[model samples]
Target: MGKDAPYVLVVGAGAVGTYFAARLWQAGARLAMLCRSDYEAVCKHGSFDIKSPHGDFKFIPEAIIKNPSECPVPPDFIIVSTKALPEIDVASLIRPAVHPKTSIVLLQNGIGFDEPLAAAFPGNELISGMTYIGVTRTAPGRIEHIDSGRVALGKFPRGISQNAQLLAGLFAKSSVPCEIHENILAKRWEKLVWNVPFNPISVLSRADTSAIMAHPASRELSRSLMEEVCSIAAVAGFPLQPGIVQKNLDYTAAMKPYKTSMLVDFENKRPMEIEAILGNPLRVAESHGLSVPNMRAIYALIQLLETGCRH
Candidate 1:
């Protein structure tokens, strides 16, 4: 990897990882992806097919390795797009690919998700990335980009770095909107205003986002949940803008009928990110002496669902 073109190791090749990896590869970056399930197919096919609103194309990563040990060289940046499940050891997952100068960019959801990783790998740069894209892996080595592909990148805690700017440029070259946010935590909380409600509701109710928003009762419940999250954010010193609740509702209502990631996981009988998405936020709220009844109820219900799935 040269200074002109950095080597990027994408840790997960699921929907979000595949989309971003394809775009980065297309933007002239040398990229390798750690794909467990799709390794055989991606290697044989030499690329993944992507169907997106921007354009349909095939992207072949520089290398598709099943394990980090197979990486020929330490990457300048390690992009982690995996599910933020509690059981997954993220530090161990990226250990082989991390170099002294590596910048770890987390593209997963939820608040307070970066602390453990940051503590594990001290001195290396940590970036917080929040994505607002609707994408799904329809099959092995195949992705369907439904709508809206925008990313918000920022340094952990606060401020922007050259690496973040470079990443934004890479995404921009592929026509993906990537912006730098000084307060990425605030942005994460803002995203929770949408994720906290839609994700779990879709799972429990067995419905898509459009259907959830269409039902009067569910829609009202979603609003209450959003209000609760906003209150927590406010007490935590990251007050969201006024009208964020309505804006999120309107956005989801206008979107195409789509299944939340949690719903997809539940249907596939896979582990959902209940802890990172719900557990951490609830912990923050409790520490701040704030109560979030709606979030607590949904968290409990999802915990039960997850318990059954794991057993």
Candidate 2:
């Protein structure tokens, strides 16, 4: 990632985007960010924070672009790290940045976004990835990593493939731990094992990772939700490991205290990313002729709380 290296485009400068961009820049990649106008502060100050397990440090990228068209050359790679609410609009807007060889890496949460995002750029290379980095946004240009910094990424074993190893190697040199996953879907669903329960529950209950993990009822509720998804995942062929729920809860218990992005949105009276995080899973289950009762309950509660906040 030097002067002659590929110019990697990182879309979304929120928590996940900033965290990876910081690392990508640090690895000597010439990075470009498709950021919102609000993050002009980040562009000007050239100062951003990343709190990782190894340590926390402030970082600045090489260049930041507000508009996709500002980037003259088509990016060799694009990482979509936005909350799902903005992804569809952003995907349609940035179609020109992708050439036949451009690789699209999705870092968003949930299982259902892959196909649609991939379909956006018909022939461009698409690689789906899951980031297990636990991060919270304290402010614009600010992010705190509460727990893990693991990245699972690779080509879709089930479909048309692309430059899988090259991108994996590039990421491995970044700050977080990166692994080339053959079963990328299972990796994504495993991360969902943590998110489907924690995100919505935290938002509705106004609890951080520690709080949701500590309550006996909350712990039970988390397990039940995970089991529901696990059942559906089995039919889809990603048989998740047993005890993953308790393991994620334990992982949360030992981490820095933080509210999730969904919780942050709830508190700020902003729309939650419920459709991708919760609604999508429920939709996927039904498409497969399956029922996910606990997930249904959580989705209902999320709807209610979202209404409560707006009203």
Candidate 3:
């Protein structure tokens, strides 16, 4: 890793991965992206076409490999933007590209998903990340950056690290606002206030976020779910700010008509991240002797939907 440019390997060329990798490349980071579905498209086009709020641009990676083993060398940082699906073996997925000094930045969603990866590679640095951007992979090698594009990152337990700061700086250079939070877990919980309500409700109701929030009954349900998550987070010692529920509502209401990641997964017949997004939180709340009926009900409903898909 040079002082001016860090070698970054971006795994999962999905919406989040492509958005961040394009930004990093624009910021002058030497990047290698491992893409699956759009490998040939990216190779043929020689760049990724990104339609963003900041600006429209094309990003060509230093190396585009279909497999981790194809990378020239171990990267300074490996940014994983893969879905936090329970069945995915993330350790095996990124094993070939990991080196002793490689920092693993999980730009992923949900709680407790990092534990297995941390356990798999105890020698590497693990940075937990959460992105507030509205991005979607519209097609192969094409992305639509719908709304905000900011990120919050922190080390596993807490506090900021040099690697975390470096990644934040890279994002900042690319015009993406990146904040280093002292408590990453608290940040994850705060994100859940938005994700819990919008992600699942969108899928369950088969409606966009705007529609869900526009209706009074569904709007109240979203607020109730957010309050329940806040209560659980408070009991777990990461109390969120007052009016956070309204803040989330206002933010969602202002956003464009968009389907959440979970909703998109459902629409595409891909497995939704039920366990990571909802199951883990429910488990934690239960262990803390708290009852989250709203979350539990949503979880049950989503589980039924998932079970139907599986069958």
Q: Compared with the true structure, what per-residue lDDT tens digits does model 1 show for residues 1-311?
A: 24468889999899999999899888888889899998898889989999998889998777889999898778889999998988889899899878899999999899877889889888899998988888989989999998888999999877899999999999999888998999988999999999999999999999999999999999999999999999999998999999999999998999889888889889999888888788999998999988889899999999998898789
Q: Can you tell me which runs of candidate 1 are displaced by over 4 Å?
A: 1-3
Worst 10 residues of 1 by lDDT: 1-10
Q: Write the per-residue lDDT of candidate 3 for residues 1-311, one digit (tens) a residue.
A: 34458999999899999999999888889999999988998899888899987789988888999999898867999999888988878899999999998999998888878888899999999999988887888889999998888899999878889999988998998889999988998999999999899999999999999999899999999999999999989998899999999999998999788788888899899999899889998988999999899999999999999899989
Please report how far candidate 1 places residue 296 from its true position, in Å. Answer: 1.0
Q: Which portions of model 3 show Cα errors greater than 4 Å? A: 1-4, 254-257
List clash counts for every candidate, in order.
0, 0, 0
lDDT for predicted candidate 3 compared with the true structure: 0.90
Q: What is the C-alpha lDDT of each candidate?
A: 0.90, 0.77, 0.90
Please give the distance, in angstroms, between residue 187's alpha carbon in candidate 3 and its true position after superposition: 0.7
Model 3 residue 12 distance off true place after TM-score fit, in angstroms = 0.7
User: TM-score winner among the candidates?
Assistant: 1
